[model samples]
Target: MAEITASAVKELRERSGAGMMDCKKALTETGGDLEAASDWLRSKGLAAAAKKSSRTAAEGLVGVAVAGTKGVAIEVNSQTDFVAKNEIFQGFVREVTGIALEKGDDIDALKASPMAQGGTVEEVLTANIATIGENQVLRRAKAVSVSQGAVIPYVHNAAAPGLGKIGVLVALESDAGVDVLEPLGKQIAMHVAAAFPLALDENGLDQDTLERERAIATEKAAESGKPADIIAKMVEGTVRKFAKENSLLNQLFVMDGKTPVSEVVAKAAKDAGATIKLTDYVRFQLGEGIEKEESDFAAEVAATAGLTK
Candidate 1:
């Protein structure tokens, strides 16, 4: 049997959000194997799941750029928010977004592409890390374009002309004039950023998510004790409502809260004297789905300064 130290127990407790004694017990049960202990706790339902959320991802910046009908958005992460404020790091993110628009959103291709300063993107990033003194990573990138319409870009909490903490690209495919559609597209993009719609439409929602909603609806309808036909109608209604609420175009306009987004697009088309269609949209929020590491600063300081129990 492996000895379980206090620090090991504390680390496990912090990672699993379990009590200190439970963490110690888990460690002891698994012979001091951290991964095995995590799984063991999960099997016994003592921990929620076997997920290890120790990666710190609190520092990152969102970048966006638009060129004619094409637009690109990216999120670059750093070890600290202080690095995000570095002028060199910010400039790298901005220029890389422009390159992403031209070279496509593939991270490998972007890294290989020539930077504006006469070196590969990767080379520039490396040089920036040396100068800025922090580890940085190109997390993700996305591009949107329209043949006949505009791809409006929006950056929330902007750090520069085309960089921020949240970036969105709304693609409107239409023959409509910019004067009539730009504002509308921007409004819709803002709504998307705020609402974080699951998918573009009913068909785009995940199969498991759809099944889960259907199961919930079926259970609720079955509780009514109605006839089979009535229960079926109730379930259908529930599913349809779920889709409309979760879908981007089918959702009601957040600005007016009355008009459906599809109808809003239609009205814009009429006003512009041209047909309009919302093809797609992309919204990127910093550190989404990245469970950051938790730290007890007071304990860390006390231990580091040799003042701990």
Candidate 2:
């Protein structure tokens, strides 16, 4: 049996939000496998539906660029928060965001495309590393465009002109006047940044995600010892609720926290004197799922000084 350390138990507790003893037990039952232990805890109804609480990602920048009727938001991540303040790194991110706006949503294509200053995007990134003196990367980019209405961009914690740590792009598609929809779209984009909805609608969400939610809901409903007919209804209701909460259009607006986003769009349309639709939105929070390596300061110092234990 794998030894369940205190740190492991603590990590499990933090991830699953279960009691310490329960976390320890889950770790023991799963032989120290974190993901399996989480699933074990959930199977016993000891944990929440979400798998684990990811580490706080507070170290990156959000970038936004608006061009004509389209807007792009890009997130570039570095190992340390200090790199975010570096002018060279910030400039690269801002330039790349503009490139993203021009190139659209294909990350690989964007990487291959030419940058404004000189070489290809990849070449410029290589040069940036030499200049910035830190390992930098173009993490992810997303673009939102509208044929008629407006695509508004929002950057939270901006480090430069159109670059920050959390970027959001909202596309409002309508024949409405830009004067009316621009502010509303920007507000909605900010809401998207805060809420981080899974998708625009149920159809946009991945099949695997839907299946996972369904499985969890079905399992929870089955444990009630209710009739199959009642359980089916309960599961369906739970699924619909899940979709409403996770889907962007169905989600309650974070700003007001009362009206659904769909209703907010409709109200904006009425005020703008045209039919408006929230065609799409893109939000990119830097280093969201990436885990950086934790370093031991004392060990590093010792190694640097060439001390032998």
Candidate 3:
């Protein structure tokens, strides 16, 4: 059996959200294999879908860029939040975002694309990690574009130009000039930041999400002592309400708090005397789903000193 180290157990605990002893046992049982240990925890129902298996659990910036009718959002992660404020780190994020605009959002392509400073993006990132004295990763990049309209980018409480905790891009396809579309796009982006819509429209929402909602509604409706037919109607109505609330187009505008987003777009088109369609959007909130490890310093000291068993 391979010896399990403290750092290995700590990592496993963070990844699986399991107890310390459970993590140590899993690592020991798996001979210090992270993946197999995660599998072991999952088999024992300690985690949900190997939460930390391929996810980046770090702090950094979600940088966004918009040019013409295209926009891109990229997540660059660092081991500590301090690196987010570093000049070199911010510069890398800005350059990578611009490169993403030109080279497109395919991460591999963006990494291989030229950098104004020196070598490829991947090379610069590697150099930064060494110089910055911390681990970092270019986690994800995505782009949205329209044929003949404007792509607007918004950074909530922006730390700098296009970098912030939450970055949003709204793609509007319209015959209206940018002068008119830009404000609309910005407002839509703001709404997205607040509403946190799951999809741009009902069709865009995945079946799995709808199914989960349906299951929850079914359980709730069963407690009402309602008949079979009425219970069915209750579940259907509940799901429809969920779809309307969670889908961007059907969701009420956050500004007015009443008008559906689709209606808002229609009204904008009527006022501008040009067709306006909210085609797509992207919202990246930094470290949104990744769980961070919160340490108990006192407990750690005691454990280190073998004062607690």
Candidate 4:
């Protein structure tokens, strides 16, 4: 038995595209031979995962789990929508979402975390890929917690209890009880799902996004054929309106369509006789940013059949 170093395992992993643990095992089994280890992984069908990795995995579930005041939302993506309905895939998402609640939002940390099932999350994910014959990715995870009030979760278009197309977690920090916070948090979470606010507040909005908006505003204001100072004021107003519409706290409540989210929460707190602050939130819409590849099935099948015209 040869000593299998970390470098050896890493080289084998890169060559075979298998999980770290699987690579290490392959190296140990092949007496630290990288080529043989790659062969071993290929024989096990684990290396096939690499071939499928290029496929866009933008169709899966956004899973949410809440434990007490803490809540987590995770997006686990699959190559096809049919696989999203698979129990194995859904079970993996549920288990991983639970692990994410404990592991926090760092994707690397979540992947490396040990699962109650027999292996680390990444290892299990690799095995799942081989078993399911589809590319699956643990895209992102976000966790939000409140020190006192409640972190409420809501799933829109739910495929299961906590699994869905959209998962939202709203953290309400307050001295109020769950009874007061739960309803308010839920409504806000639903609003987040529907409105897709870019940030919690104006300050939280992305600088680049603001700059882009400003540039667009500046261009459009200039097109008005007005004076320089007037154009500047116009640009300012346009940017301000953009920020207000996109920021969660400033955005009008979806429920009422008139009251801002900040006001809605404040009114809820007032009605409940408590100081409730909407602190943080996470909205994981499944495959929100991934660019999915489109292919014609007839053309693909014809190509596969070697019947090119």
Best by lDDT: 4
What does candidate 2's lDDT look like per residue over 112-204, in tens digits? 899778878766765555455455566677777878878888878777777777778888888888788888888898888898899999889
In angstroms, the error of model 1 at 129 is 3.7
Error of 4 at 74 (Å): 0.7
192-229 per-residue lDDT for model 1 (tens digits)? 98888889988998989888988999999999999989
lDDT of 1: 0.82
What range of 10 consecutive residues in model 4 has the weakest lDDT sum? Answer: 12-21
Looking at model 1, the pairs that clash are none
Least lDDT summed over 10 consecutive residues: which range in candidate 1? 46-55
Record all residue pairs in model 4 with backbone atoms less than 3 Å apart, i.e. clashing: none
RMSD of each: 12.0, 16.2, 10.1, 2.3
My TM-score estimates for the predictions, one after another, are 0.73, 0.75, 0.78, 0.92
lDDT of 4: 0.91
Winner on lDDT between 1 and 3 is 3
**Candidate 1: where are CA atoms >4 Å away?**
1-55, 216-235, 299-309
Higher-scoring candidate on lDDT, 1 or 2: 1
